[model samples]
Target: MQNLENGFIIKQVDFKDNDKILTIFTKKGKLSVIAKGAKSGKRANLLDLANYIEFQTIKSKGLDIITTISMRNSFHLSKDKSSLYIFYPLEVISKIDRVDQDESQLFDLLNFTLSNLYKNQDLYISLFNIKTLLYEGLLSDFTNCFVCLKPLEVDIQNISSMMGISHFGCDLREYNVRGYPISIDTVKLLRYIKDLDLKAPHLGFDIKETVLKEILLFSTNLLESSFDIKLLSKNYIL
Candidate 1:
């Protein structure tokens, strides 16, 4: 039987002779496929990382075999300063287990985030992280204090590495947690992103360098703790 799917090439490894192994994140989920004679041909450059592709494959014993491929949307990130942001999400998605799970939402989020990276790299990266957490049901409520259940106003801090947020007077040692202080601006930014409509057009907002750095750090911590996967491409963004 032949299977048809549209996805992004998240990873690729050289195979013997003229073959290459690819990890594609499709609407269904992540799939590992072997593309024969793809190393040196018209298909060589077609199956590149971050390239959205529509392809046909045949299931074999271990991995699927790619029979044909057509390019969809190829994002040019070679010289883009936010190249690291592009790579980190791909690496994270590649590590996700391809079990019998629906990944359509993740696929959409990735596509949207990649498309908007050039517009605001830092914002998009933070958006991607926050969305990923929400999609995975790992994100905590940022609107109120986890301990007091009161509306969070100012001087918020990340209590737990995963998604715990608390006010300044909260006992950190009681929770047996420690994290950096998160400014109210960063908190508001995250809340704004969480409620944003990705498909709509809107004016961009300005963010301070300090706030951006704090948000990035908080996002990295959230991802690492929730997924237990280290993003090797993070160095590019840092």
Candidate 2:
């Protein structure tokens, strides 16, 4: 049946030159779509990742195909690193979010997150934490233990060799195999990211690079183990 759905583009890849596959986190489906002829201007450039818009689609028993897409005003203001990091969630989305499923809440969260991401690149990690929490259905604030739910106060002691950070009493390694520490900085960052109004610009922090690495590593471990996806981003980073 022909249908309409609203969504944000998660990932887009060229198919046969003009055809494109768009993994859209839609109000109804978190999976990707084969938007035939999208790259050739057959559709407005909703193929752009994070482009928020409505789509005309055809639903099959198996998969839904996007028939047409229209540009919405919300997508035009973003630029730079903000644009890139917003797509990073796909590293997680591609793994967990299912296609052809009703997921309007996920869609709204994605839209709001992207809006924030476009305005605040420095807060990308925090935003990433939010997406991760949404996927896991857990709270994103790192202030509490991923375990005991007790407020923590570590000064960065225990860390994973892969990205060990022993500050905030979180130590779940290898897809959260259970033995590692998360730094206070990670927790603090999460707390700040989840609650701070993006409308308010971040005042900046004094956390060291090592602490940042711990958060990244911890999140990476969780996401990779949970989703079985490789973040080639580490390989490509210059």
lDDT minimum window of 10 residues, candidate 1:
154-163
* TM-score quality measure for candidate 2: 0.65
Best lDDT among the predictions, by candidate number: 1
- Residue 153 lDDT in model 1? 63
Q: For model 1, what is the C-alpha lDDT against the true structure? A: 0.79
The CA-based lDDT of model 2 is what? 0.57
Each model's TM-score?
0.89, 0.65
Q: What is the C-alpha RMSD of each candidate to the true structure, in Å?
A: 2.4, 5.1
Clashes of 2: 13
lDDT of 1 by residue, 1-238 (tens): 5866899999999998999999999888888899999888798889878999999998889798999899999876657566666887898888755587888889999999889887767777888888888888877678877666676765444432225566655536446555556777887777777777777835276789887887887887787778888878877776
Encode model 2's per-residue lDDT on 1-238: one tens digit a residue: 4666676776777777677777776666666677777766646455666677777878766457777678774554345444556556555566664656667555555566566655444345446645556455654345444444444454335433222222223444223554555555666665665565545646365766665665555655655655556775433211
